[model samples]
Target chain A: MLNVKDVKKDFPVLKNRDVVYLDNAATTLTPDSVIQSLKNYYQNLGTSVHRGIYQLANETTEKYERARKKVADFVGSDSPREIVFTKNCTEGINIIAYSLHHWPEMEGKILVTEMDHHSNILPWRFMANGSEKFQLEYVDVTKEGRLDLEDYKSKLSPDTVAVGVPGISNVVGTVNPIKEMTDLAHERDALVVMDGAQWLPHRKFDISEYKVDFLTFSAHKMLGPTGLGVLYGKEDLLCRMPPPFGGGEMVLKVDRRKVKWNDPPQKFEPGTPPIAQIIAFGASVDYLNELGISEVNEHVDRLAQRAVNKLSEIPYVDIYGPKEGESRGGLVSFNVEGVHPHDLATALDSLDNIAIRAGLHCAQPLHEVMELNSSARASFYVYNAPEDVDRFIDAIKEAKKILGGADER
Target chain B: MKDKPEIYNQDVVHHYQNPHNKGKLSDPDFSVTEENPKCGDRVTLQIKLDGAEISEVKFHGHGCVLSIGAASILTQMIQGLNVREALELTFDDLVENMGNPAKMRKDCASLSLNALKKALSGW
Candidate 1:
């Protein structure tokens, strides 16, 4: 069992007000350890890596590479050379889509799920509209808001070049069966890309266990600093794919007539990276390791289940995602009848200073399937507690009285 | 607005629920639809011109309270006003009629007015 009190103390923002932050699906609060590591890097050694041979540069390079190794070990990768740093999860996915167009013999079909965020959808849309002319297909989501395995099985074929799906739905918090999906895709020789942005912070993940070709996630969503993301690929796949961007540090040798590319990880990283944030991200991994990802997952799941039960007690409120007692991540997306999500969010904020996300949650297509313009989402993390869920439920009742006056509860 | 929820005052909520002139105008002289893609707030404003006056004005769409309330308030404000007078109305006029919205909701408050302006400009 994890202690919510200890985790809350690590985040200074939690003390700023009587506010209940239920927007962890968007971005998590950074802990003091991550913040202190950031300060230590900039205050003590403010220098670039892989450029200088001096003690400072060598130390910085070692720390940076050590962070990469930490991330690799955290994800259970065979080698640290497989992890490439990027701006955010969006950039990591874009790199794969960018390189896919140039694969000479690869087919043009790409299968994606409707439950994916826009970042996962748009990159492939660009490929289809651009010169690559890739045929993009969507796997239908079941009525329960989970991916339809039947639709996915039919969609997977020899022509399908890649399959991109989120490990967990950001809106409904449905934890998809990624390993089975990956195995099915591999049977047809199709590569699987898992959007681990919402998965890494909530559960235990091992890259080799899932056998995914590419995994992308953002640090900010996992209690780390922003402007840092990870793209972990199988060594053979990374070596086979072309570099997405070319600039300093990515090339071994440059010539007017010929150019020699660097190794897999370095070949993808162009220009100076976010060195400070990466080091802080290492601290965040350490924080998670100390608490244990399985315990964190259990804590959040307990909170989410309690929230779902309390919110479902209100007759006027409609919750989306998994059924009661089903396994889901630490989030609940819902809406009150006859009340717009924005109005409900504003009402909740005013009543109890509760913070929640009230929008499409970037899965507009999923909302379209749900037949709603928008919905409000309340997501929990390590720091959130059952008391917070109680407050959220009370605030929802207040919103119902204020906004959904015409609806009966 | 910071300490309290001034955005959805009683007046705004009342106007949102019991909006005036809230259906399609029959045989409308002009019509326009606008959607704020951010939150999927959409509104369509229709007008029936009686000579130089806007004899009838109605709106049909879905949006948040601010946009819907502003549309209702705008329709009531310009129902009997002349076409020239309605065209001269600014976004400030809309804000004055409805309470000032938050910085993020400025677009929601002005969406109906912008659509109305576009409808008249295209005329």
Candidate 2:
């Protein structure tokens, strides 16, 4: 029941006559409201916060705090104190990585999935290095892109500190059952961190209801400005975890020798934050809230299903991940026969200005597990419609013809 | 030139469709495989030499139009050149040969050039 026409109007980039963007999974186009909010921030109240006692700094600080509350409310967290701002999702993961390294009770193994993005995988690997006490194990995924629960169950042990899993895959668009996976990990006395980078913009997710220990996502993926990310941790756990960085604005008092870090959200934010981007992120959340998340999910699901069906009809195209609409998200990954993913993407772009992602999508382990070096991915969002799918399919067919057909192989 | 296709043209498409000098040159003086892995582009280069004068050059692999075209063109370009001359082929030359491809497609088009350099490195 989502109106693509109305949604398309919100993004000025859609007006480009030749461009048909299908690379939403990489990053979405910012809405007009978010862009306006960003412009307003710089034009009107551009000042350093928490330092000056002037009216401009005070107003900026209040607006920044308000943006934090908006992000917390969007994810169904009770208080804004739980939301910590970072550079991007990669920094958010690193924050947790550094915090776990400092934990007194940190011991044993960390459970992760082979399907995790490099952002989720490398930080833990870097933290576990030279520590004989810590081990890292990955849960294997099935060929259909579903997590093998049996494999996950076998890896769960008493010494597991946390299980980091992606809510939705960047490459395959497989939606993991975070609640179920977290519940299983909890039974084994392990904390859970959900990488919601691909999940937050497309679907409705309630952090309170899910009761996940921590969740992280980049704002740029959700139609906001770049260089901003969100990390939502339970208040109690966040208060106990040490801050990854220490500098101005994060400390309550600084002595000659020692310094006392501020409480939960503020401690994690070090140095000058990306104030304008955060303000724009708040506008993006407001825009998404207006278009209900459920409706957005429904729209994306329809587009993805339509794309999968139409692309399947083309001979020599092999799709990855779940076939059922409910099991997958708004993305479809595939490789065309007799063509490299880069070639297919390039051909498609030339023929019809259709932009699709082609690569390992920063999930090298997932590709290694699937035995594929790269894949062509087309992901959808609220602005995408059935007509977009038709055009995308037509572009692919044209690419095949221009590349001398699949029969040429 | 502005009216030409962005990165796909008749010549590039034809090379991708029916690439010349494809497949390995058995018992050749030099051979190598280069891959981008990000875009799943793979290329294997095989070169045969007759006392510093190129005797035969061939390539076999899987990749996109730019990559395939570059490999096909590379085989044709390096046929009579010495190993040092073959090593001089840069990404710019590859893009120039394809009517100056988009900046994004440069990596794909340069695969064959990189493979030739890799093959020469072993020699």
Candidate 3:
């Protein structure tokens, strides 16, 4: 069992603040090891990577690339060459969409689900926009906020070129059957792109097991530094696909008329990369490895289930996502009757300084389909405990009383 | 403003539950809808002018306690006031009429005023 008290000690924010932070779905708290690694990089080795000839530059480059290998190993990829660093998860998805938009063979429809964040949706929308050869389609989401597999099977035609699905809904907390979906999409000869932003933090994901053509996630959401994201693509697929953006270090030979791209990972990562963030991410991976992803996931699931059970008992509270005891991510999205999400969020804050996300959570299409104006979400992390959940439940009742929840029966 | 649960303030709850001048004006002289992109709350403010003054003013659409309550309170305040004077009524002025929570989320509190300004910017 993962000890919450020990994990909480690693996070300075938890020790410093008396606030209950339940917004882990948005971003996880940075731990001391990751922060120390960042400070070490800036304090000692302040040189750029993949360029300079001196020992300091070469040493920094070694550390930077070693971080990539650690991340690759953490995700169970045999080769670090498959991992490409980008600005964030959004940029990684955009890179794939950009590369596919330029591919001559990419045609017909680009499919995405209603649960996808704007990061996954807008890139495809921008790709399909004003293009005759390409079209955008949305897989239906059931009333329970679950992905409609029947709708997905119906839409997975031969003409479907790609499917961008979330491994877990950021808002609804629905843990998707990504392996099954990937297997099905592969049968149709369609490329599957999984948004792993929510999955990576709470679960163990082996690329070979899922066999997704592309997986994109942010390191910041997994106790790593911000401004760094990873794009894991199949070796052959990365080799075949073209890099959309071009700059320094991405190309080996720049001809007078044409340029020869370097390789898969480097070609995708143009210009100077986020050196400090990448180095710190390696420490984050080490941190997770020490805790063990399975134990962390199980601990989170227990707390989330506890939250679901307690919330279900409240007559005025409505919860979204997978039902109690069903598989879900580390968050719970809910709404208080007759109280707007913003009002409820504010009331919670005023009641006990409980920090929760209160808005669309960047899945506006999902909210629109669900017929909700906005919703409040309480997300959990490694540091969050059962007591935190109880405090949250108590705060909800108090907040409801002041917010005039429902019509008082 | 931060310490108190402003949305549940007796005045805000009363205004939100029983909004004043919430219906549409027929053959309205000016009508505009403004949205708080931050939280996705919307407010549509409609007005009928008699000479230089706002003869009738009403607000409609979906929003939270601050936005809806502020719109309800502001419409009642704007009645019979000169159109230019209504435009002069700043967010702070509206908060003074209502409560101080409006100052915290000024965008939501000023949504109705933003619509009114958009509808009358041509003048």
Candidate 4:
């Protein structure tokens, strides 16, 4: 298990006396190492990469490539050639959507899950609207928030091009069986893209073991700076797919009449990149590696289980997602009877300075399927502790008193 | 103004705990549903009219404290007003009624006010 005290010290935000942050699913707190790396980049080695021949540019280029390799190793990709840096997870998914225009035959029938984040759902839906050959089929999820594999099996057809799903759900904290899903999709000759935005920071993942065609995640959600994302596709596939955006650094040569694009990863990464943020992201990954993902995952699982057990004891609290804590990460989405999620969130905030997310969490289809308009979610990261969970539970008890009793139900 | 606790301000928790005139009015003169998908704040308003005057108003549904409180206070505020006057009510009026608007509270307060206006349209 990770030394929770040491892990907490890495994040400076924990020093704030009045803030109990339980919103890791929205974004994680950056560690000092990552923050310092960003500062060092700006202070000393600040220059554009790939385009310059000067000493500073060469140093910047080497650091940028090293960062890419670090990300490649972190995700277990075969080579750094497959790693394409984008602005964020949303943009990464959009690249896949834009590539769908090149494959018209498979556009009409794309398969996605109801539990997907809006970033995963909307891009394909937009493509469907723009092309007659494009349409979307959705797989149902179980009441406990696990993917209904039987439903997914039925939804996969010969016409399906790809199945976009999440590695971990932002709302429910359900860790999907992505390897099985990807294997099933590959058997049907369809590609699979895993949204790892909620998964990467909390646990260690190997992309090669899953053999997914593409993987996407954001740095901000992983304790790095915002506006940076990593998109990993197999080198062969990346070479076949054209760049979605075009500008400097992404082209080999350009004339008024024609332009030749760079290789797989560089072709996709255009414009001046978020250099400091990417370097900082590498630092965050290093920090996570040092802590060890196995320890981090176990710590998070223990915290979630403890929270579930404690929250379940509260008279009318309705915790959603898998009942087994082992099947979930360090997040719990719940609602107290007779109290709306927003009211519960506000009450908790007022009572204990506890911060939690209260909303549909951009998973509208999932909420609609579950017959819930919204929910209150408390998500955890390495920096969170058992005391945080205790405070959260106590706040919920106080909220119950503030919003009246369970008798209203 | 009554030395209200910061957490128990007339604007903060009152409408959520004891909402005013909540529920549907069958065969009401005006009705509408307002929603803010971002925060999952939803409200359904039903108003009764006697000629141009709103005789009664009620709201029902689920939302944050700010939203529920605003809806409750709105029913109390608009009960005796004319349909035109209620229609003229902006989100600012609702925020003002709830004391002062915080940066984030404005959206929740406005959602109920917008629902009220939409409900008043056909009346």
Top candidate by lDDT: 3
Q: Kindly list the per-residue Cα lDDT of model 4 for residues A179-271, writing each as its tens digit.
A: 899988888899998998988887888986888898999999888899899899889888878778888778889999998989989889888
What's the distance in Å from true for residue B83, model 3? 2.1
Weakest 10 consecutive residues, lDDT, candidate 2 chain A?
A400-409
- Clashing pairs for model 3 are none
Q: Per DockQ, what order, best first?
A: 2, 3, 4, 1
Give one digit per residue, the lDDT tens place, for model 2 in A99-120.
9878888888998899999999
- Compose the digit string of candidate 3's lDDT tens values, residues A304-368: 99999999999988999898899999999999888888888877777887888888888889988
lDDT of each: 0.88, 0.86, 0.90, 0.84
Model 4: chain A TM-score against the true structure: 0.97
DockQ of every candidate: 0.42, 0.48, 0.48, 0.43
Q: Model 2: runs farther than 4 Å from truth?
A: B1-7, B25-29, B48-51, B99-103, B121-123
Deviation of model 1 at B100, angstroms: 3.7
Tens digit of per-residue lDDT, candidate 1, span A21-122 = 999989999999999999999899889999998999999998999999999999999699999999999999999988886677775699999999998999
Candidate scoring better on TM-score of 1 and 2: 1
Q: Work out the TM-score per prediction.
A: 0.96, 0.94, 0.97, 0.94
Q: Which segments of model 3 are wrong by more than 4 Å?
A: A406-409, B1-9, B102-104
Question: What overall lDDT, based on C-alpha atoms, would model 2 receive against the true structure?
Answer: 0.86
- Per TM-score, the best of the predicted structures is 3
